[model samples]
Target: MDGSAYGDIVAQPNWTRSTHDSKWAGYLKSSAPDNTSRRLAVYRGSPLYSRLDHHTMSRAQLLKLALPLVKTHGFTREALSRSVLYLPGTPHAEPLSETAISALFGDGDNARRTLLDAWLDDARTDMKSAPSPIMKDVLASRLRRNEPILRWLPEAFGLLISPPSGVPPLDPSPALKHVASIADEACHIVGDTSLGLSWYARRASVAAVYGAAELHQLASPATAYEFLESLLSSSSNIENTLVNTEAYAKYIGRSWAGIIKSSGVF
Candidate 1:
């Protein structure tokens, strides 16, 4: 999923000691349960061997370059194309064409979803680094980052869940994944390391609160904080009742359905 288009520059004798050793170390560890050495050899033989430092960049790299442009271009393909212009070194002779953009990101709504996911991931990263480890403050910081692209978010949310004309609606897993990620990250930040049913409850409750708060922000930006606080006030009860995995899943589903309905994005 995170492969890069560019190939390696100079093949190193020791693959483990390559410049991207640190980056791939975790990958190697995770894949060690399988035949790690054989997999490593295959990757070394592959074109993407020098992916970390190459003339061309990965989609993740391109998206990172494109993120700042979202403020001006509102998550359009134009913003991604123009991202090449703002690359640290010399700019590309021309922007990426529609075909190239689609290939790099995806076709139709998938492209926008990819961009939205990248922005959300970046927001989570920012949230992780906040000075305050408090859940409320961390979530507030996460919501604040959305202000830059708030105008386009409702449309983004719709595209994330709605399919093209004549196509069936897509699963809202991506949106749900991001919400879970935010909830998980907030728990990690707040040092909530409980196991068992409580883990599921805490995450589900946080995700529900954040989902509602974010939608409330779209309608009433000024009072969203107050609304969030009110939701948080009752989160304990919500968590207690969501101990069952099925119940927690339903809670999250309802939260997201409400978000879609209230945003008029369905």
Candidate 2:
């Protein structure tokens, strides 16, 4: 098929590489498992094909032209997520709503710094008391989506654990204390983390809940609540024991709690 036809198919929100053959085989035959060859053929035929020449245009300029076409075609969140993970230097048709354009371009460098600062400020404000419930809910909501904060957590931890130049030194003890308080509150909502566990086990129970929520994004559109439910339902005795022992809560209390605590120098 020609570039226009291919572009039309790709523009659809639900379009996948598999969709090309299953849905639009009349225009193009399935040449390979992936539609890479077909996509290249279409690109070669499109007006933008000439612009691929590095000397002819800058990467930013190409993205400026291509983004409109991508949006016009109806780019989906699933496609954008995959592109962010798989296509590094390549320009995406659209940015993920939770991610900043600058962060996406720099692969979370800017985002990590921004979030770390925010977390520090928030933690300091609540150093003497538990973090506000509203703040906990806000964090939980962001963790559920494919947002920049979730994506940048590992890097943020890296910085917190071993701060680079100009990055301030941090003491994670206050953050841990706050996390423990939130976790204890969450336990009260679910069942009880203090029932049969030691003090360390109780702390670990809280850590587990936060860890589960942070990882929930990896399983996306499926929420952290659903994932926790599934884990609770697991047949394995150990799995069941962990959730039950921890008193798995409906909502993650302070999703960044365990992360901030665990990334300390100690």
> What lDDT tens digits, residue by residue, belong to model 2 across residues 123-199?
32222233334334433543432243344445445554443343456555534544555455444444443444454
Whole-model lDDT, candidate 1? Answer: 0.69
Scanning candidate 1 in windows of ten residues, the lowest lDDT window is: 5-14
Q: What is the lDDT of residue 198 in candidate 2?
A: 50
Best by lDDT: 1
Per-residue alpha-carbon lDDT of candidate 1 for residues 1-266, written as tens digits (9 for 90 to 100): 23331232122212233445324433332211124345445545555555444333335445656677777787788877776664433558888888988988777766776777667756776676566998888888888888878888888887767755525657677678768889998999899987877888899999999999999999988898888888988997777666665677989999999999999887
Best-performing candidate as measured by TM-score: 1
**TM-score between candidate 1 and the true structure:** 0.69
Residue runs of model 2 more than 4 Å from their true location after superposition: 1-117, 120-148, 163-185, 188-199, 218-223, 232-266
lDDT of 1 at 194: 75
